[model samples]
Target: MDLNTTKSLVTSKTFWGAAVAVAASVAGLAGFTVSAADQITLVDQIDRLIAVAGAGYAIYGRVVANRKIG
Candidate 1:
């Protein structure tokens, strides 16, 4: 991606906010699972997807930085 796109993705508040939200959701899932077993299935699946996307976003910054350094 271009520099602007790289900067925007890495520095954007929305991106990091979503990452934090996903992490919190996953953390809550453990304690909430027993009570809401039915809904946990779908929510857990969605959380996994969001986590993957969030990981990719965070990694993009490192990959870009590595390219510049190496």
Candidate 2:
């Protein structure tokens, strides 16, 4: 799949998987071990947080716009 054509980064499984891997590696470097299941949970939470932030930004943009939606 071409990442360039993807509408949103949060919708990509590969992106989330990589994020989990990076998180695990960072935690390991900090002397904290994160289990596989915990890593999976972290991916889900991060995905949700990003999605929510995007939605919130969209709403804020609309509210602050000078013109009404058609």
Candidate 3:
């Protein structure tokens, strides 16, 4: 595979791992706190995470499109 494809794969994997970790941490915290206020904050955090992931995917697509594969 070309450099861009390789980089994209690695980046995507890392992003997914990080997302999972964040989700797990949030779940654990919610289990302990069990508060409505905390739940709202968690929802906001989830929205931010979705935006970040979307941006990452967009960047990956741009990089892959610009790369020339043989």
Alpha-carbon shift of residue 39 in model 2 (angstroms):
0.5
lDDT of 2 by residue, 1-70 (tens): 5746646767766799898899899989999999999988877888788889889999999999999889
A best-first ranking of the candidates according to their TM-score comes to 2, 3, 1
Put the candidates in lDDT order, highest first.
2, 3, 1
Better of 1 and 2 by TM-score: 2
Worst 10 residues of 1 by lDDT: 32-41
Candidate 1 runs further than 4 Å off:
1-38, 66-70
Instruction: Flag the better candidate by lDDT, 2 or 3.
Output: 2
lDDT of 3 at 48: 76
Candidate 3: segments with Cα more than 4 A from true spot: 1-33, 66-70
TM-score of each: 0.36, 0.73, 0.48
User: Candidate 3, after superposition: displacement of residue 26 in Å?
Assistant: 14
Better of 2 and 3 by TM-score: 2
- Backbone clash pairs in model 3 (N, Cα, C under 3 Å; residues 3+ apart or in different chains), count: 0
Model 2 lDDT at residue 64: 95
